[model samples]
Target chain A: MFSPLIDELINALRILPGVGPKSAQRMALHLLERDKPGAAKLASSLQQAIEHVGRCKLCRTLTEQDICATCTNPQRDSRLLCVVETPADVLAIEQAGNYSGRYFVLLGHLSPIDGIGPEDIGIDVLLERLQNEHIEELILATNPTIEGEATAHYLAEQAKRLEVRVSRIAHGVPLGGELEYIDGGTLAHAFNSRQGL
Target chain B: MFSPLIDELINALRILPGVGPKSAQRMALHLLERDKPGAAKLASSLQQAIEHVGRCKLCRTLTEQDICATCTNPQRDSRLLCVVETPADVLAIEQAGNYSGRYFVLLGHLSPIDGIGPEDIGIDVLLERLQNEHIEELILATNPTIEGEATAHYLAEQAKRLEVRVSRIAHGVPLGGELEYIDGGTLAHAFNSRQGL
Candidate 1:
């Protein structure tokens, strides 16, 4: 049958979520049969990332050096800070190309059931950074999940004592969507956060 | 937010078939956070397989040594040889656990349009092997595609002159499938290969 090497390659590809044995096998075969350059690129990238990427000393986001480009950029607004649950979330916001503020990555959200607390997720570090960084505004850009909401609310309360303006991203029926198809949570949020048209 | 290493890892994972940017980001983060053991296992397996498994000198299947265990085993019916397109196909048949005969892996199917001919897919090597070996029955287990059919026909013609019994795998509606939904090619195959109940 296929070489053990092929199987290993297939299994390695299966590290992606939702990729089962069959999908892994297909991917491995495809890499071998067609995309040699792509496969080599992927392998080299994996090795390099594993060897080089580390947490930013200032913001806790993933970075190649002690400080991320966002933190080091003098042109960015140091007075405006956006907080998110993970490093990936920061990238998602950055990709939108609208946000011109600095960011703080939490590494995780508050999950009391899982024993994850604010302190555990670097809240103390964030607080220290907030006080010292001369920030005027704090945007809690965490996801709309229950844990994300709790974390954001907790951060807002903390920011109030520090005399920094805090705000949450509004939740509503999505753009270009039917109200009837929207979920109960979003519907409730839409009703609560309603504005006169 | 995420480290450059994490970004690179996500990009690497995205190169796989069916993986998008979001999925790759999720997967890279997952491996870093929860599936460390799985990732390490996968990496170790990759290194091991790459270092260990090689092509079987006889059948072209993956093997730890020069000849595959299947090819060298004395208990197998060497006279009744099954031909498949790849080592993966051999494993599939083996998993089915019905075929006791030995196998010859072609490494690839013939595709004349892609400049892959009979010899390029190892048909000449197969012929030489057949001439030297003690094979009686040659079962063609190539896939059910147009290229697979053409290769089977060519092999059958070649084996016909050699006076060896040749058979192609039956093509029809799959087991547990309904006849009403069966395609024309399968219906025709079923009609031709029909057996009395």
Candidate 2:
């Protein structure tokens, strides 16, 4: 019922995750009503990021530069490498704040049905980086899913051949989660990594 | 915890309606993951709309032209004018698919407390348009809220003094709404306009 321009705007807004027709209409109305500058800013930023950002050549993380800021930062420990399945995973690990190391971003997890393999998702590039950077340890920080596990295992074997120590992140109960409600996999992990209190 | 760029992206995403911190982060990650072009589309549309859209001088409705399409349409019954509180209200009435009249957008409802008055929301312009366009019937299609009611009443009185016929839309139980749960005011209206079975 709206003009074609408004319809195009609504369609553009619906591209966001979880935004449906009604939500898109509401957002478009709001942009038209209260926030012209904010809307303009968002559009400009989206265009700029989409046009400019690409995978960091070294780590495959999303970045404006060929080498991401993380890769170029001298203060970050280059010897400890955290391997993750996606750029988002890198951000999540970074948010948790315990690791002071660098990252290796795989575009996707190992999904056999999808024809994704180690070589397809920059694992070769990671190995090359590890060899060139003299990385002392590699941490498998991919999710605890089956594909993540397989990817980690494959990377661990590869790292071993290169004489680099390989380890996986511990997964048990999340922070503040009750032990009584913990799942079987988590309980098993906690048990396997048992240490003296 | 992530890069300043990611933080900026997340903060920008939060400007969308119902997008909290978690949802903002999720959207930011989603853009970083699978839908860079989609995100770019949203941003580009936002900027384009912001740059392109301006209020119609005649109706105060959002439009790319000095006059909105609704106001400019020669075939629409110029003598039958509908008054609404905002441009969105105009769209809502248009979507109902029954109104074939031109519109006057108030830009906002009457709010004396916020110092919003007749002149503040282009009441004079509406009057001038009504006279200039030779409108005979004015439909008070503002919302049902207290402010909306006040504005409608005020405009209705003005239209009466101007010798233009004024009519308020009938309100009763909405379609698919339970009549038993309808408020007294609406029930009274329904009774007053009761049709013969």
The numbered model that scores best in lDDT is 2
Inter-residue clash pairs, candidate 2: A43-B43
lDDT digits (tens) for residues B1-197 of candidate 1: 46556777777777778889888888877776556566666555555555566678888887668888888889998898899998779889998998999988887788878999888888998898778887899999999889888889999999988888899987888999998998998899889989888
- What TM-score is obtained for chain B in each of the predicted models? 0.93, 0.92
**Residue-by-residue lDDT tens digits, candidate 2, A1-197:** 66667778999888778889988888898888887767766776666667777788888888878798888999999899999988878877777788888998887877888999888988898889777878999999888989989999999999999999999987777789998898988888888988788
lDDT for every model?
A: 0.81, 0.83
Q: Candidate 1's fnat?
A: 0.42
- Candidate 2 deviant stretches above 4 angstroms: A178-197, B1-6, B179-197
Model 1 earns a TM-score of 0.92
Q: Per-residue alpha-carbon lDDT of model 1 for A94-194, expressed as tens digits?
A: 88888999998888899999999988989999899778878999999999998999999999999999998999987899899998899998999899999
Per-residue accuracy of model 2 over B26-87 as CA lDDT, tens digit each: 77778867887788777767777777778888778888788888877888988898998887
TM-score for chain A, prediction 1: 0.94
Worst 10 residues of 2 chain A by lDDT: A40-49
